[model samples]
Target: MIMDANTIKDELKKVGISINDIYDLVNTKESYPLAIPVLLDLLQKGIEDVKIKEGIIRALAVKEAIGKASPILIEEYHKIAKDKMMLRWAIGNTIYVTITENDVDSILQIVQDDENGMSRQMFVLALGKVKSEKAEDILIKLLDDEELTPHALEALGRLKSKKAKSKIEILTKHPKSLIKKEAEKALKKIG
Candidate 1:
């Protein structure tokens, strides 16, 4: 089943993947090459990982694979998150991927939904990875969403957006001490 680069390319051509795809899979900033095959195989089988380590390697590769991934591949991953255990996937995926600014924006928008708090939280933490102006409004909006406050504050702290100062300050007065603490931390960073 092993072959040279050309053989691998020919075999993959029949499946619609290519050598450049391999480059993206293995060349991410994170060491994800080790997981690429497992993740791709899992996706092809349309199965979800029940444990973190069960597919941890693959998850890491999938994460980095998104860094320069084609939009179609990104969408495919998004679909996988939606159709499966999204929270778990996000938590697992974040460790290995360095997705683009667009992926961060897409996640922020999706987390706006009330039922997607896990995604919201994951997206918040992920802002630490791909900080951008697109995340500014979304992070600020979390101030009004009681459930997202903590994660939002974390995102704001990491994102360091100038506009976040006003929104972050308001959280310092939140009834929940935990949120207030997070807000205080975010405001400190904003300054």
Candidate 2:
């Protein structure tokens, strides 16, 4: 079912959370397109374990719920993104957006997880999104990673960084056909 503001309101009310914390979220004014408004509608409320978990969960869902985000909404999105499952998904989505410098460590760890292959895709996608000069080394490191090389190469090419050129120069010579193909394509594009 499509969740409406009423459901969010009800959930917040369950834990005695007043919309005061998120008055802006509920404001119905301005052009906030974020899934959940930038308010601690659930987090700042007084509640115990159950509520805390529920609050985090509800807060987490906002990332999926939103279709667009204002700067305030994006800030709120990243703050709640500290939640694990939610953060994972958010990084996957926001990897390309202009991220705050502080968010780099955690998101980079997502790229490094090796265990979660999907995260490599997310990390690559996010790097392509950010297109930051800082991500060049990590993108190049993806070249050496036996496990994550494919996605990393793809991200590197998509990023098309001048720094990425050296790595692509090397990857184009790699033994794997798929990797070589992608590297060649990236080289052609960036050339």
Candidate 3:
């Protein structure tokens, strides 16, 4: 059964997402088997409420939603300029879970922008899911990023990036135990 706007809103409310409007629900006649595109369209149309947008983004994090939502989510990630922690984390988590090889370039673009801060943390780690040499190089350079160094180490290890082995080695003795732990884990993976 196709859910109407009110039904969608009610469902969202049930999950603690109390929103006033259902911004652009898909047409009832459309053949979309899933609600992913409807949610992605709202995100693309620029929902102003961070919480609502975050809810939609998180809802679309499922594996079935990846091909349809990844590009739109990346677009939304770029659109966010403020330091909204929950929203940023939501996007990062969604992208991290759904990220594909095709999304690597865009993820790299976002990760390279230091202004995005730790919001890019999950994106850094998501790079591990793709085995691109570009991803490996970027992860290596990200070793210099204090906030993302641990995630970078983890991603390189996921890639089993022999190229990054030396950089990962340097972090093994990092002052932060978390960094040291990740560095060791990454080295084990690389080996």
Candidate 4:
């Protein structure tokens, strides 16, 4: 049964149902689209609860509702500090899911401005998803970065840029087995 927004809100008010329980229900039923407005409202309320905000972000990501929630997520991203890695990761990933041609420059700027490896990785992954030649070029430059190589390689593969084929072939012999395996996989994908 499809639960309407009002019913979902009413259910949340019940004594026994927790936010987590609601999250599970939403996930199991694949009903996150229905909950987008509610989640956005909760996020906007400044609930001051890290766990709740995290859950809201996760739900948005699962539902692929990032386009609708981008403004709020971007606001939350600015409000968050680099030290809060997990929350930053969640927010970054959500921003990533909504990436578009318009967001490419800003995303690159965020990657350059942020020193956090994890945050940079998420942004690079997002760049890969953009499937633009510019994004492909950026990922190629990042291939030599120890912290970003795996993600960059994965993104390049996702783009299937024939130009990246040679570089990926070189990585096939990398000392790290994981990198080598990923490179080989990316090579196959590019082919």
Each prediction's TM-score versus the true structure: 0.64, 0.52, 0.82, 0.79
Q: Which residue ranges in model 2 land beyond 4 Å of their true spot?
A: 1-34, 38-91, 94-102, 115-117
Clashing pairs in 2: 35-66, 95-126, 96-129, 96-130
lDDT of 4: 0.72
> What's the alpha carbon RMSD for model 3?
6.5
Which residue window of length 10 is worst by lDDT in model 4? Answer: 1-10
Q: lDDT for each of the candidates?
A: 0.57, 0.53, 0.78, 0.72
Candidate closer to the true structure by TM-score (higher is better), 1 or 4: 4
Q: How does residue 154 of candidate 2 score in lDDT? A: 69
Ranking by lDDT: 3, 4, 1, 2
- Tens digit of lDDT per residue, candidate 1, span 28-142? 4545343445444433444333332223223444544565432333344455545455543444345325556767656665567665545456556666566577667777776
Separately for all candidates shown, the number of backbone clashes (residues 3 or more apart, or on different chains) is: 2, 4, 0, 0
Please give the distance, in angstroms, between residue 153's alpha carbon in candidate 2 and its true position after superposition.
2.4
> Highest lDDT: which candidate?
3
Could you tell me which residue pairs clash in candidate 3? none
lDDT of 2 by residue, 169-191 (tens): 88878999888888888787677
State the lDDT of candidate 3 residue by residue for 1-191, as single tens digits.
Answer: 34344555765555455445543321132322246655765567666666566667777767767677788888877777757755776788888878888998999998998888888899998999988989889999999998998899988888889998887888898899999999999999989
RMSD of 4: 5.4
Compared to the true structure, candidate 4 yields what TM-score?
Answer: 0.79
Each prediction's RMSD over C-alphas, in Å, is 7.3, 8.4, 6.5, 5.4
**On residues 1-191, what C-alpha lDDT tens digit does candidate 4 reach at each position?**
33344444564555334444445643664444556776776677665567656766777775457567767776777687788888888877877676766777767766665376676778788887786777788788888887778888888888887988888899999999888988988888888
**Cα-based lDDT at residue 11, candidate 3:** 58
